[model samples]
Target: MQVFGIAEPGAPAEEIEIATPELTGASVLVKITHSGICHSDVHCAEGYFDLGDAGQMPVTDAGAEYPFVLGHEIVGEVVAAGPEAGVEPGDTKYIVYPWIGCGECQPCRDDNENYCIGAKRNLSIALKGGFAREVWVPDSRYLIPVGDLDPAWAATLACSGVTGYAAVSKVLTEEVDRPIAVVGTGGVGLSAVALLAARGHKNIVAADVNEASLENARKAGATATVLTTGADPVTDLVTAGGGKLAGAIDFVNNGATSGLALGAMGIGGKLVSVGLFGGQLAFPTTVMALNQLKIEGNFVGSLPQLRALVDLANSTELPKLPITEAPLEAQTVNDTLQGLAERTVVGRFVMVS
Candidate 1:
């Protein structure tokens, strides 16, 4: 198998040939057909969230004798399954839930494996990832079958789509109501807009300086789009809120966007921090106390939730999403990440093997 990964921090993804990895337990070996290039990939490779917060894992040296494959937005076909598995040979396709948990953990037992420390213990290293021709996952639990779905886009559903859906689901479960705002307009942000709209949230606002992204947000069901500019760029968001926002999701975790998303919220409005695209942002504790607002972080969801999302996406009557495919050559892998970093790619970039 040939895999592409970062040889070092701030370095480009290097292509290397290696022996096929052995499957552990119910682990299924997949021939990666198309894996999406995600913004988190850029963050992980670059070292934005490198402080290794409490319970956060530190990234290892990529320049070691072995550089781990660096991809989690994986979609691939099941070529072979282990001794007792769900995925079988010739299955149309499936998406990988990157943040897998050990079955023995308490959280994993409760199906809230997103916080599974045991799973993090194994997959946190830079030695293994999905950016390769063929890779192995610990179990079929990570593979949510997306039969007859667009292979190129289906892989992206694993992370961006799943996370978007889960974030919105959290809002609905909390019975939160009001006009909502999305802080960023990247692929995941746009997907969140679409998912929220599908769930009947029409009073949605999108923020981004880029016209292309703003336009895409509109296509994804954003009722209003705001271009962050000038002093106090959040003014547009507040204006779009028409007094106060019911809720907001900060898909971009920079000072500017987070400020706007939190500032626009009305009392009791929840803010779900989705991404670290722009890195850290400090919120005013006084306002949070005064407004009685609740904030939470979102991670890519579980396999069962992913399956539900797949079912929802399949039931939609609209044309398939604007999914683009690129060959998984050395240059293609390098170009995919570079394009994401430069904000040149609009939709997900699925690498075909």
Candidate 2:
């Protein structure tokens, strides 16, 4: 098996050859077909996350070690499966769910393993993920069949798609008189825009500092686009959204975006922060109480949510975000990570095997 991985923290990924993993117990082996290079992979490769004034949190502190293979948004074909595994060998394709946990834990038992605290077995974080020709899944339960959708696009549903759907789902529970703001206009933000449109939400406002991202958002069904680069971006967004926003999904979850999201909301508005961009939340307690605003943090989502997203992809015409495909190589992987960190890439970047 050939893989691109980091030999040390903050080092560039390099190609290495290793013996193919054997399928044992309930383990299943997937022949990698497509993998999405996610922004979180940049954070893992750089080895730390900014925590505002508190300080930096090292990836090592979160159980990441050297010789790391970092790619979780995976789509592949089943090559081999253990007797206990539900999948069979042949041409069966599936999206690999990377967030694994100790099955006995309370969160895992409740199917919210992404919130598990006992043991973090998340792929690309703890285990060797899909940055290679082959990956070993612990069980077939984590593999969701990808039916009829393009494998390159289906690859993103594992993370960005589910994350965006989960974030948008938080605010879409009730009808709103005002537009819902989607902050950031990145992969998750664009996904939210498209999903909102697909689900019949007519008034959607997309906010971003990047013109290209705003254009992408517009293509993905944003009724209005706000270039958040003025002296008062919050006011600009609020004005563009017709005076007040019913809710805001801050996919950028940084200090600036969080502030803008909070500021652009009307009373009783909901703010769902879903990005791992890293920063502290600082807001006035009096305003929060008076406005009765709710700030919720959404993780990537549950297994059932992933299944629902898969069904949606199979059944509906999803927003077609830009996709760039490249061969999975060390240089390409390194360059893609750099591009993503610098915000030079507009849409999903997928590595084909």
Candidate 3:
């Protein structure tokens, strides 16, 4: 297999030859079809996360080593499954859920592998990412079948979908009937809108400073769009988000976005920060205590939550999220990761194998 990876933070990614193991090993062999470029990948490459905390991370899992292939949003076909694999040959394609978990951890035992805290935890961090001609997933648990859907689009769903779904569902409560506002109109935000619409939630609100992104949000089932440029952007988002907002989701994960989401939330409402964007918010502790407002941090969901999202994808006839693709080798880093950081990419970018 051929792969592109970085040996160190901020290092130039290079094309390298990777050897594929047997069809039946500790991992499953997937014929790579598509992978998405994400801002998280750039962060990892730039060492925003301490590899020292590499404890229980997929990148530092026991069986794999770096130079890490950064992509985690993956969709591909099963060429061969491991010894205890669930599917047989010729089955429909699926996604690599990305978080390779050690099934024995307390979190894993509870099916909360995304929060695994065990020592020497299982991971794909150092493992080869999906930016390759072929890749191997440490376990079949990571694979979710996506038959016939566009691999590129499905790839976006793997990360962005999981992130959005997890964030919204985490803070949402039955107490509020008002609309849910999703800030940032990128892939993750769009997926959040699509998932909410699929769940029959009308009055889904989308906010972005970009016209193109705002237009894209409309296509993703947003009932209203707010361009966040004027003074008092919160007023616009508050109006777009229902009068008494149930929750505000910030997928941009920056301090500015976090603040906006916080400000936009109505009393007793919740603000969930899901993106890795560099931002912080000074909480309204007084209002939070009095109004019962909430601030929650949501990572990707539990496997079952992800499975449910995939199951919904299997049956839903929702409008396809717009996407652009480039061959893995043909891509330049500036266009994908940097584009994400710059908020220049309208939708997801798929690197086809």
Query: Top TM-score: which candidate number?
Result: 2
TM-score of 1: 0.87
Question: Each prediction's Cα RMSD?
Answer: 3.4, 2.0, 3.9
Task: Report RMSD for candidate 2.
Answer: 2.0
| Residue-level lDDT for 225 in candidate 2 | 91
lDDT for predicted candidate 2 compared with the true structure: 0.86
lDDT of 3 by residue, 1-353 (tens): 67776666567677887686665644688877787887677676665543322322343333445676778788888887788877665646778887656677898888887786754232236457776666777777778877766778787777778787787687556553477888887667877888777776777788888888788789878898989898888888887765857888888767677777777777778888787655445666786787788878887777887788777877886556667888776255435777776767765678876
What is candidate 1's lDDT per residue for 1-353, written digit by digit as tens? 67785666667777888776565567788788777777777766664354223333335532223364677777777777787666677856777777666668888888777766563522324236677877777787777776777777777777778888888877653333457888777667888888888887758888888888888888878888888875766677878756577788887766667777888778888888877654456789999999998888887787677888889888874223577787876677678778888988766677887
Best by lDDT: 2
Greater-TM-score candidate between 1 and 3: 1
TM-score of each: 0.87, 0.93, 0.85
| Backbone clashes under 3 angstroms, per model | 0, 0, 9
Tens-place lDDT per residue, model 2, 1-353, is: 67787988779998898666677778898889998999889988988877778888888786666788999999998888988987788777899998888777898999988788787888887778888888888889999988888999999998899998888888884564478999988678888999988887878999999999899899888989999888989888988888777899999899889988988888999999888878888888888899899999898977778999899888888875778999977888899999988989877899997
As a whole number from 0 to 100, the lDDT of residue 287 in candidate 2 is 85
Pick the winner on lDDT between candidates 1 and 2: 2
